[model samples]
Target: MNIFVAGMMMETNSFSAIPCTRDSFVNAMYYRPEHTGPDPEPAAYEQFGYRTFLRLARERGYGAYASLHAFAEPAAPCRQEDYESLRDEILDDLRAAMPVDMVFLMLHGAQMAQGYDDCEGDIIEKVREITGPDIFIGVELDLHGNVTTRMAEASNALVACLLYPHTDFDERGEQLFAIGERFARGEIRTRNHLQRVPMLGLYYTTLPHMMAVNDAVLAAERQDGIHSVSLMHGFAWADHPDVGAAVIVVAESGQGGVPDLARDIGRQFFAARDETRSLRRPVDDILGAIAASPEAGPFVIADVADNAGGGAGADSTFILTRLIERGIKDAALAMIWDPIAVDFAWQAGIGNRLNLRLGGKTGPFAGLPVDGEATVVALADAIEQEDPAGGLMFGIGRAALLRIGGILVAVNSIRQQVYDPVCLTGLGVDLSALRIVVVKSTQHFYERFSTLATGIFYCETPGSLTLDFDAGRYSRLRRPIWPIDADAAPA
Candidate 1:
């Protein structure tokens, strides 16, 4: 069997001011077909999820051909020329390597280039144009993927990871390959159906699996003829027309229950929409909760609005400023994206004190950059942590740990969500020794930080990815979407 691998991942936030240029991917992550091998190091896997498919093909002795592997940090819609150049590279490769038995595409569903709103759908349609209808095309989508009719109509099958922090990356990779193998061997006829639900909001679907939508997906998958069920949470930060939760049910092609199952799940989501949202509180209110809590030591408060994962600048000082004002001590926060501060700290060297301004550089929402006398306690060229799911290493660039008035703040050069403890522990901050820990993330931090915190609180601060969905401004999105329109339902 011959298998082709290719991927393009970028979670876009239309509200963000950052432009995702070609340099974003080039500087962050970009690889040619020849650059990748069958087995990849953990750090590479964390950066790019494409290695799993390549490894699978190699292990099975199948003809595996890799295309461009590119990933950019979450930001505003990609540049038109930049996205087109990369898209053409992947398509051009597929065109050159014709007559392939199968194709596996790893896509982040919420990509929106300058001129293209449905980037994933556009790529899949182009691939279909090259491969025709005979070849088996399978896709692995992020749960946050904004599933579209174009994508659902073009691909043979689509599988999305069930976890939020994506612990099931390998499992989903194997599942997509399994679907392709079965199709190639004539084991079972499969059909993927997508049912878009008219709902838009931010929510946490972390472990302990409290979300009802997750439970419903599992229940639907257990039913006869259901091969897999995915609740594409839909990236709420992307202001596309199809930006809403979707139910994708895969089952036997001839099975009559697929559509019904899909519709039922969609309805379930609409009925339980309130439960799907995270409980958020104002910064001061959340801080009060932390002070009153009788729980034993360190508590974690998520600065959700400033989560870099959803394209908000991680440098927002809404939470950090308040912590400083409250005179909170023994509290640590990793990473405030302030390269200026980091550079100053680096110049001061370790154990040296310097007065500097940190974070609050973006806008009014970011608050004023805090000014204080800080001591550089720790410095790292880069910080990386192994993902417990498969040892995938997630990391960011140059960082410095600084202590200011008993508060430890991690200053980073790059922007990324704090998904793992290594971001702090690597910078020499003793997480256990602190009374409070603040992470600039919405939900991704749940998997790692929850394990260490005595209690977790979600802060409803102000920034680009703010959870006040109804208050968001959108110029292109069509109206009548849920929450925005009280009587809205899927069209």
Candidate 2:
């Protein structure tokens, strides 16, 4: 059987001011039809989902036609032309690579283009229009997706990662391919049912192993006739019509219990709504908590609001400035997305003391600029790190480590979250020596940072990806969704 693989990965934040351009997608991870093969071990930042699927196709002795694979860091709505150009490129390639038995896609369902609210669904339907009804379509999405009826209807199977930090890309890819293979071999025809629960909030506190939603999904999967189950926690930051929690169940055809199963799972999620509540605290509250604790071990602070993974600028100085003002010692705050600061540091040379204004350059959300004299402790160009999920290398362009008092700041030209420990160690800062470690990430830094720290705290600082979703005035989303309305009824 022939399998066609293509992907467009970007988690769009509707509130963000940054517009995702073609260059943004290209710079992050861009692959064409020419970039194909059985790459069992792709780069850390490479498109692992497509690569894994391609590897599985090779293992199954199937013809795999790989098309445009582009992924940008989470940002605002993609430009209409940029989105269309990339979408068309993939669609055109899929058309040229016709006669494929299956179509496998890697997409972040929360992605929004200028005029397209449901870009994933749009692409899926377009692919369906091209491939016709005969070809089996399977998709792998980030759990943060807003799974719509159209997305479920257009695809044979829609699978999302159970983990929020999304550590199971390869496993999910394999699962998606397996389901698609069942369709190709005429084994079991699958039908998908999506249940959108009226809930809008951050779910950062729940770990993968202990999440009730994941447990409910697992329970559903264990039921007879149920082939797959996924709970899209939903990107709360997005302001689209379908911007809320969702449950998707893929069951064997003729399975009448699928809808109930999907609803049951959604109900379970809604019942345990508190589990998904954000555990973000103000900076002062975090500091107080730290003072109350007796543990002298490293504390990993999650600067959630500034997380680049959630479309924040990743250059916010709110937490860093507070730490500095409070005279916090032996702490390292990383990956402040400041291109000018990095350039200035490079020009000043390493080991040289220079007066520099750092961070807060991305406008109001990033906080006021902090001006101070600091020593350039370390400098490195083309700094790259392995993404904890797949060990794929992502470049953090020209980096500099600036030391202000006892605080060490990791400044980079590239706008990226400090998802990995390498973002710090790559700059020659010994994380072991630090008393506190601040990462500009929401939850992606959990797996790595958790291992090194004695305590971890997620802070609700002022920035683009704020945990206080209710405060934002969203004109697109419908009324009565969870805490936003307080008395909202669950769907």
Candidate 3:
């Protein structure tokens, strides 16, 4: 059996001021097969979901063709020309590798180009046009997306990351391949139903109520004849007609009650909105909680609004400013994406002190740069961090660790969220000694960070990706959804 595999992932936040370019993808990743001509070997894609497909092919001794793997940090819509060039490259590769038994694509279903609202759907539709209906088509998706009907209808199987921190990337990737193998062998016909819930919000799987949703999805998958279940907690910043929570249930063709199961999950999730709302605390609110709580050390505070993974300028100084004002000591903040600061630190040399301005330079929402004399702690020319979202190694280019007052701040040239402690630890910032650790991420940072934190706080703020569902950011979104209407009912 032969399988053609490729991927392009970038989440778009329509409200972000920064535009995503080709360099964004190149800087993050741009991979092609290592060999040329006859027997091409796939590159050593460390920690990518696509690597799972290649691994399966190698272990099973089946033919695999990997082409044009691209990934960029979350930002505004990608340039149309860049999107077309990449999309066409994948199509051309798939055409040249013709007559494959299966087509597997790793995609972030929320990606958007200048003119394309549904990049994932567009790519899948185009792939379907090339591969035809007989070929088993399976997609591995990041659950934070606008789960559109076009994508679900065109592909035979759609498997999304089951967790918000997305620790299940490789697991879901393998699951997709297993389903594809079953379909290709005529063992079972794959039938999927995407049931949309009229609610648009993000949820942390670590929270009790949200964990219940994850448990429910997992339990549903273990039921008879069920192939998979995914709860698509749509990206709130991306404005689209299909932007919201959705339940996708993949069941064996001719299986009964698929729609009912999907509807039941979606409805239950929506009905529990009030309970999940408790996790969505605003910036000052969480800060107040920290001051009042008697809990001793190592509180993991998520700088949610400024999360680069959700298209926020990781340069925001809102939370830092608050912490500084409160004179919070023994705290560490990571990955304020400021290349200038990193460059300045490199020039100043480690163990030296210099007056520097950090972050808040992107847009109005970023607030002002934290200005003060910071002592450089450590520096690295190029560093890589483990990303739990896709089990991938993320490059943090020309990074530096600086201490301002009693706080240790990590600044990196790469625009990304801090996924693992190594992003700081490698640079000599000790996590075990800190009283508070603030990471610029929505939820993907939770998996590993939770272990170190005595408590966790998710703070909503006025930063780029604010959690306010009624923030007037939507124009293209379908009317009457969740907080947008409050009484909007899903039919």
Candidate 4:
């Protein structure tokens, strides 16, 4: 049996000013099938379950038809033409690969295009329209997705990554394929329901409360009829009516308590969010922790508000300026979005000194520019960083290592969060030698970074993707949600 496979990964941030354009899609990746087109153009990312699915297809003795795979980082609503064009590309591929037993997709559930509120839903719905419901459809999504009504209606199985660092995409990919196989054979009919928890908060799986919730999900899966239970922590940056936490329970058709269990877990998750709130600290407090530390190892500070992954400008100078003000020298802040500075450094070459204006170029919330006479320490055309998505390598284009006083900063032509130590190490900045390391990210940087740093700090500042889940920050949240409105109803 032949199974069709396609992927389009783009997470939209309704609050962002930048629009995700056609070039953005191409810059990330635009991989067409080898059979249809001349050599496909490669991008920095999109290695999601590529190897696993190949292994699975061989193991199951099934032929898998390849389609286009593309990924753009989180930004504002995608351009209408770009979304439609890419959607058409996948649809066209599916049409050509007819008589397929099943379909598998890799998608960012929160993808929103202009005039279309639910891009993932529209893709699935269109695929279903073409396949006529008989072809089993299975989807694997990032945990940070808006599990909408349309998506649940279109697909047979929708499973999200259980971990926040999203290190489990390969595992989840296998799970999706397994479900899709069972669905194709008509062995068991699935019953799925999405119960929206009326709240928006950052809850990482590493935390105790979320850990317990994940544990419960694991326990629930151990039951006879339940297939999967995933708490889709809706993307907070996306300003939509469906922008809140939700629990989706996919179970057998005859399962009795699936709906009840989903609702119960949703309520429990909302209640447990308060415990997750204490994880972040003020910049000053984090600095205090650094000063009070007895260990010499690098203290990793995660600049959460300015996380590029959540659609924030990656060039925030709030923490960088603070560290400079405190006269902290043995530090390295990485992947600051400054293309002009990088080009200047490239011209000057390594070990050469040049005056440069860095960061704060995106917006006001990005803070003021850090101006200094910086010495060029290192320069690389592209520094590759291993993504948590199964060790997939992503390049930080035209990277330059600038030493402004005691701090060695990692400036990138590509606007991206630091996923691995290679973001620094590739630029010749040693992790063990540095006293402080600031990564423009929230939770995604924890997996590889945790082993090297003495401790990790999630630093909150005034910028895009703020932790404060109030209605003032998000004006268009359709329903009353927690912290925003006290009386919002859950489930």
Model 3 over residues 1-491: C-alpha lDDT tens digits? 99888999999998888789998898888887764112346454454568888888778878887877899989999999999999999999999888899999999989999999999999999999999989999999988878899999999999998877787788898888999999999999987798988887777676677788878988999998899999888888888798888889999988999988988898777876656456768667877777788877688888888988888889999889888888889989988999999999999998999999999999988998889999999998668888876667888888999988888899999888888888878888777787788999877787788888888887877888775665466778887887778678766
- Candidate 3 least-lDDT 10 residues: 35-44
Better of 1 and 3 by lDDT: 3
Report the backbone clash tally of model 4: 0
Write candidate 1's Cα lDDT for 1-491 as tens digits.
Answer: 87778888889988787779999888766877543333333343334577777777777888777777888889999999999999999988887777788999989899999989999999999999999987888889888888999998899888998876778878878877888898889887787888888777754565333367779888887777777888888888777678888889888888887777788878866776665354778888887877887875799988888888788788888787888888999999978988888899999999999999898886666778888889999999867755453444556788999998878998898888788887889887788898899988877777778878998888787676766775357655657777777888853
Residue 27 in candidate 3 has what lDDT?
85
Tell me the whole-model lDDT of each prediction, alpha carbons only. 0.81, 0.83, 0.85, 0.83
Error of 2 at 3 (Å): 0.5
| Per-model TM against the reference | 0.93, 0.95, 0.94, 0.95
True-structure RMSD, every candidate: 2.6, 2.3, 2.1, 2.5
Q: Pick the candidate with the highest lDDT.
A: 3
* Number of clashing pairs per prediction, in order: 0, 6, 0, 0
Which sections of candidate 4 miss by over 4 Å? Answer: 36-51
Instruction: Quote the lDDT for 102 in model 1.
Output: 91
Residue pairs with backbone overlap in model 3? none
